[model samples]
Target: MSPAGAQPIRAKSRHHRLQEHVLETTTSASLLSTSYLATSPIAQQILARDLAECSDDDEDEVKFDSEDDGDDNDDSEEDFSTTLHGGAAAHLISRPSGTIYGTLRPIIASQVQGSPAVNERDLAQSRREERSLLRDNHILPPKHRRPFRESALRQLYRRIFSTKVHESGCDSDVGKALESSPLLQHDYLSEDASGPPSPSPSETDVLWDCATVASSNILKTTWQREAKTLAQYSGPLILTFLLHYSVQITSIFTVGRIGRKELGAVSLAAMTSNVTCYCVIQGLSTCLDTLAAQAFGSGHKKLVGLQLQRLTYMLWLLLIPIATLWWFAGRILANIIPDQDTAALAGLYLRVLILGTPGVAAFESGKRFVQAQGLFHATTYVLIIGATLNVLANWFFVFKLEFGFLGAACAVVFTQNLLPFLLFLYVRFIDGMECWNGLTRKAFTNWGQMIRLALPGMIMVLAQYFAFEVLTLAASRFGSADLAAQSILVTCTSTTFNIPFPLSIAASTRVANLIGAKLTDAARTSAKVALFAGCLVGLFNMTLLSSLRFQLPYLFTRDDEVAAIVSRVLPICAAMQLCDSAAAISHGLLRGIGRQRIGSYTNLCSYYLVALPISFATGWVLGWKLEGLWFGVTIGLCV
Candidate 1:
């Protein structure tokens, strides 16, 4: 059977391994059965390419010769031996017996070995199944997702303030927006962290949980509870501010009766000292608001007292520079006041005023410290006594003994000193001393942190007040008639402003507490409610001021000319009152969250950059007089 130049026949077949336990079909025709990855898609692709290239080969007829082939209907044995290897490689033995051979592989061989027609539907179905299996096994492809820590602080605030208990939550988103704010965010407060201890069930705000409160009775109960809680803190707080402002009003009232010159001089002096020293002190004191409120809210009772003491120490140290400014107010008075006599008297007044600078720091620190711990009533009690005593002293010294302007200054200084003395006694003897650890060395230790907080606070509060003093100074340049009218208007507006200022304090304190206690949702709700209430109160004040514009001036003096001047400026004052109220509350909110820097920038832009230029342009350039000055104030507030 040998012949010269004979070609050797070649045999080829594909091997496909499969997972034996698979319940469904796969792309590779069977589940791969191997410890390693049994199906290399790359190998399958190469084999497919080879098979396609060889498929066109001819002289490969595969037919079996059966013995019983006489009848056309007789069955013949089928050959399962030949496998097309890329249509190029096929082996057939040239045996003398006329036999053929091929490999019988599982799915691959059965699919294409002898079949002339391929069903694409079955092939596609197999491919889909294989892909699905690969996905289930998670081979090669990795998924991407955002980190949960991004909004950690926001979620944390919500959980802390919410009365509703949650199994798991992300609460940091709300605070995430402010996380980058240096003044508000603490180093320890991680956006994705669990901050201070969450408020206890009893401390949690029930109003916040009223989303599920279906019945009328339940809603009523919740409102009553929240209202009572708010009143307990805000009532005495409001009264305290009212009484304190009454002290200043008493000084003005006593000074006003002496002479118009004295009234204007004292008013200018008060404005000067306030802007240069007192206002800045008050702003710096807010650091206590942030620290003590949270410390108390989180049940860190001792920390509140320590922070209070720290603020006290910090303020006294700051008073040195402030007192120096007050010392030179008389010389600086010429910068604003055109009258030589008034400026000279104002100088004497500033010299006398600087004596009370330390007292101002002490008084403000004590008030904020006590109030932060929820001892609202204590503040009211102390302030009422101080205010009453100041009025009595003012009457005796000014009218009874004729000490005049000096009497007014002395009485105010005494009253300011009285505030801190009373608070110290109360803290030493009263029920609210739970948080006071009694002035420790720790107060002096963490001063750097306190200074950092105080600077922004001072700037925030300073911007508006400094601008107001400048406005008063601008009024002084308008002569005694304008100054006296401005004096009356300023005093009256400030005294009446007590309404919204207390609400602002309540808002800030409540927010700080809720935040520290981890009552995040409650903090947000409280802020919204406080702002709404402040707007309502402000509108009411604006209406009252507008209605009494012409009539209210007689309370201070019988001077028809001054009263007429006040009437002309009343509209501007009325408008200013509305913006002022809102701004005051916003200040409180900012202080609560330790965001004083933002408030500072807001005030700086509103007052100096926006309001001041317009006021000067209108008052001097356009000759609108005192009305222009007041209008500028309103503009600042609106801004």
Candidate 2:
């Protein structure tokens, strides 16, 4: 077929056959069915250019054929096919009869061959159809819309005042915003004309259904109902269980590191710092929880801002006393421990812990505010951040910093302070809620509410602290070892008993909100749920601690004498959880009803007037050592 001396092409040699096979495999599938993809308007132009490259040599022939046909329709078909293979023509030769060209085959031939154009067209068309369907279904378009800042602000106002507009509206920004909002807009009718009547029955029913759906959406994933709320109790219970075990282990390990005097000092400092902070934060934060929950449940939006402002006032007031005490805690430590060195260390611990007070309190407030809006996951994340910081700081300070008790103290402060600041910042900037402005200027007005909430709770905590101090003194008369063992046992209890803290917290808010909204049945259901859950958690903790009784003392000491004494008292520790759980849950329920005074009185009677004296009498007068003392305290716990 060539000019001169060229033989006709024949079958390939073995090597040639291999070469052909390799080329066929190497050719891309994309090039084979490209014509089919060209049906898309965007792809159609691309196909035309590719087809021109394929028919470059036959362009004149095509031009002549087009002229003879005297029709422009054939020219378009020629352009399309030629454009489709433009990139492939340098290497590909068209098969005379088949759709495929030289050295190439379709990868998905069966899928494309019957109606290759239809196959690709359908795929492209399907995507368009889907987009069209979405639009037709009334989906919001993906266009930038103006921020509804004023609307959000107004809504926030309505949340606080709920459109009541009592007291004839004051000159305050909140009052002004409330009065100007469309929610409060009620057009007056002219004397000559009457206004339209309200909606008919069918319209009312439709509105009711819409409202119900919206309510259901808010409650769907939340622990709001009887079944779901109760089900949620199990997770927090298990998490608390794990945390308690870890805390107990940590206390025992810490006490085991040094002597009894050191152990007692550290334990006292730790308990005082933690419980004080807990009382301060929780007590002040309770108001936010109550306010936020009421605001949310009743659909009063601006109340969130007011609640936060009120909490801020309480926090600032409490901060002064706490900060002052912390600054001078070392001087005061002398009276408690009677050892200059131990007292100094306790004072240092107090000072270190105080550094985190503001942050910790703020964090607690933010958490309660978010949680009252039904954000459980926010609480979960806050705990996770605090716990992670706590563990990391403990490891670094104790092991790497080599600061011992001081390091542990610093670690606690670091976590407590950091989490609050972070949470507060997040709530302000990123939470996207308009009411976040409450953290700004409005926080000054709610001082009265915060003080009222903080005073009782702080006093109660301080009383508990004093009671522990007396017990420490009583235990000290038995010698340093007895004091050390008692300190370790208390740490173990702290860890174990903390398992119900979250449950109590959840119960307090859940039940309180329902009660506030007059959902008596729901409130009762939540109480039962919390009670059953707390009992199960308490039982589980009891079983776990009892099972590990023998090894517990060893974890806290290498001294055989001290370990033996502690091991004997392990049974008493096991029984204490039962009383602790009942009291803790009862406190929670009472707290929900704003009866914290009841909780304060109960703690005073049980620990101060009862447990301390019994411990001293049995350990000293009865000559039974630490075991007898613990047994008496357990009996006091029971009463």
- The number of the candidate with the highest lDDT is 1
lDDT of 1 at 544: 89
- Candidate 2 on 425-445: residue-level lDDT in tens? 666666626444334444454
Error of 1 at 215 (Å): 17
Q: In candidate 1, what residue range of length 10 has the lowest lDDT sum? A: 98-107
Candidate 1 per-residue lDDT, tens place, 1-639, comes to 101221111111111111111112211221111100112222222222322333443122212132334745322111111111111111110000100010000000000011111123333432432222112122101122225665878677644553331323323332233334333313323333343333222111111121112111111112222333445556665676677678778887777766778878887887877767776776677566555543342233455676677677777887787678767777777765689778878778787776777777777777666655545456667776888899898988777888878888888877878777887888889856776666566566646656765676666556546666777888888988788888898877776677776666566655554443333455576677777777888889889888998888877766788889998888788887777777777876775676645776677777778888989988999999888887776787788
For each of the candidates, the C-alpha root-mean-square deviation to the true structure, in angstroms, is: 32.9, 30.5
Clashes of 2: 14
Off by over 4 Å in 1: 1-234, 290-314, 317-325, 434-446, 504-536, 579-603
